[model samples]
Target: MLRFFFVLAVVVPWTVGQPVDLEREIREAFNLGGFPSLAVAVVVGDDSPVMEVHGWADRAAGQRATRATQYRIGGLSKVFTATLLVQLRDEGRLGLDDPVSKFLPEGVKLPADPRGARYITLRHLATHSSGLPRNPVSRTERESDPWNGYSVQRLYEGLARTKLAFPTGASGRYSNLGVGLLGHALGRSLDMPFEDALRRKLLAPLGMSSTRIAMSPAQLKSVATPYARQDPSKIVRAWDYGCLAGCGGITSNLPDLRRFVSLNLRAGLSGVEPVRGASLTELHTPQRIWDGWSKATGLVWIVDHTRDAGDIVWHSGGSQGFASWLGFSPRWKIGVIVLTNCGRPVDDVGNRLLRQALKKYRKLSPKFRAMAERLVPHLVATPGDKVKGLFHEDFLKDVPFSVLKNVLSGLAKKHGACSRVLRVDPADRPELANVVFQFADLSLVTGKMGVSEGDPAKIVYLRFGR
Candidate 1:
């Protein structure tokens, strides 16, 4: 079993000078958004996660929102479903390239193009490249009941009548139907319900007992009362996903979701079944690029790669009357979870809070300025040959100078040459520094540089972008 030895309940201490009014900020958001209730948890590095709850769990019942309050995570359940699929793949139960038809019910036929059903694979489904629509339900049916009146038999019937958006694996598109199908098929493969299979393979091992599709009596009482976004006084009914629960039916609280983020931060390196780092890495790696690389999709995780930092992996979900967002940056080892009873777009709130925490916690180091001072000249003067000499030999192994040159050249072409080093600030890592530079066109760029521990401490990591 995975141990919870690191699950500290203590609050993270803030630096002496930089006092972040996290609770105050969250309260303001809750009040301004007119949400019924809001629960937020932030996990930074090895320190304990900090949680803040505001407003009412159920205004009519006179109950307050608390850390223990549960909310339906909606499509965030896809993250869990995807994780379960990865676990099964790692256990050698199935292959990612296996065709969808292999696991589907006998009568269910997923729509395909001229190439046919054989081209659709679990890999394509997980990556949302299976050419499936967002949902099998029609617009009129969805308007009447978004989650209800949908069943496995209906899903199969819908597939029989539906059409593919494009050739399988030809492009990227978001598809709840595709991921939901993957989860359903995996359950059939294991001869178990998707909920039970996910609990055994992922949730139970991680001690996420509170996250589930079916709420216990106690959980039902603790769950925040769902409400319409435009009218908080109007209560909304929770969804019952039935056979399609694999897509977006799980309800989870802040703590359990925090643990989920922590697991991803560790890259799933240690656990009972011990999800191989390679498998988790595959989940985080970009499987398809979209909108000219502005956005990318990993298995089921949405990935945003920052040139100077690392990848920010995230997912957001919305049920009839609940909205939730979970996001983390692997490079910074920081994550945020936002849950609310009101059905509204709270992603901006989560994103802002995460950016604030990242800015506050990731202080720049003194060593960074020195490295940037030395490298800036070459970085600005020559986008090509000479810059390679400044990088450590070992650093070249992880990233070739050619790749670095291309990145720097691309930035320069867009923003113009570096005119001056504006400031050098502390970074989260001791060996790394954050440098702000003013370009010839007056545009600003934040550059990150890290050095080795040798006598010379040659530059090992270099990245520059907005």
Candidate 2:
């Protein structure tokens, strides 16, 4: 099988002149969906020609989110921690197969009682196959520290008491506990604190000034306040990871993140002299294969593909009050980063624009390009009255019939064909409808074509076009 840089060309385009305004679309997406603000940075390998900002950083103060605005990048922090381990292996400081026992305190070692512990290697942790629990440290999160105060001391304490759920190296399971332990152990191996080790080993060299597990005093002033989008009108508190900063505790702005994406997309071919292409390949390759799922885990990068898009290396993060996503297709050398203050799901947000943008770049061809140009501008200009709250929040939220009538009127106005999705007994679920929407010849955009729940939750297309 090929090891590095699989070529992935855009296979479809959703439209012609699909809303080319990313900045406006980003802001509108957040605002319409009740998000406070967001920041985005896009790059075409090493050169970041597409950086933009939208909305407020602090909703209360109305501070605008910008390219330099600092944001809490939740689970996206895992990718950074994973990359450090790969670098250590490259530098002879660690081995991919090293056991957790090699670097941790003796008492914390996997006991002889757990037959599977012995087989767990650094690869297991990186691949999430150590049989560790999700938020094993969640004990702390459930109790006093919403951030899960699993400090260095508590980490060692927990490890000392840790036991295996199953044999190590047998399979992969996504676990915050596994990656968090890796971060802490690497610090111990380096004889430095996790914060210092990450900075000295990765950040400084990569020139990522704003990327850090813990923010500096100067950064604190600029950091965006986190929020949750739940309505009833109130402020949501920030999340705490206690000491498990490796799981998701970093704060960074889009500028610094652009560097990470650029580096990954080019396969670390940074300067004129490419960095070891081998390590980059290892970072993007899957350490384990689960079930029949083709997704691969390379350190922190998740290599996933869709029939329409291919080999996208990506990760998304969500904490108490923030959500973020980073994805790039190395084949095309293009990447996008989305950081939002409100803890709204980012995958849906990122993918919505991802395909649309790729098509506009000519990455996709004539037949499949979306026909959104003639109608989208007018819709963007009008009030959200027709589609207001009509766009399904999840595959679950119900939309009003009035919204549909409005959309039918819209298609007529645009002199285009209007279509409504009517699902049969076993069909109307969100999972199937979303895939069918792009092919539906409707003047308005919708997330899905059917409903699953009842009444307030029975989600229809939840869209209006006219």
Q: Pick the candidate with the highest TM-score.
A: 1
Off by over 4 Å in 2: 1-21, 111-117, 142-144, 216-218, 268-275, 362-466
lDDT of 1 by residue, 1-466 (tens): 1111111111122222567777777888888888888888888854544699998999998999888888999899998888888899888899999997888867676677976445689989899999998887542355425657357777788888888988887877888888888888889889998889988888888888888887678769978888987788898777776677778888999988887887787774655244666677788888899887867998899998765446788999988889999988877778889999988978999988887767666655455666667666654534758777777777767776667676666656666776777777655444566577666777766765677665665777665542
Off by over 4 Å in 1: 1-19, 115-117, 138-144, 268-274, 363-431, 435-449, 454-466
Give the TM-score (vs. native) of candidate 1.
0.78
Kindly report which residue pairs in candidate 1 clash with one another: 363-426, 363-427, 364-425, 364-426, 364-427, 365-426, 365-427
lDDT of 2 by residue, 207-226 (tens): 88887766557768788777
Task: Please provide TM-scores, in order, for all candidate models, with all chains considered together.
Answer: 0.78, 0.70
State the C-alpha lDDT per candidate.
0.77, 0.63
List, in order, the clash count of every candidate structure: 7, 13
What is candidate 2's CA lDDT for residue 316? Answer: 93
Error of 1 at 340 (Å): 0.2
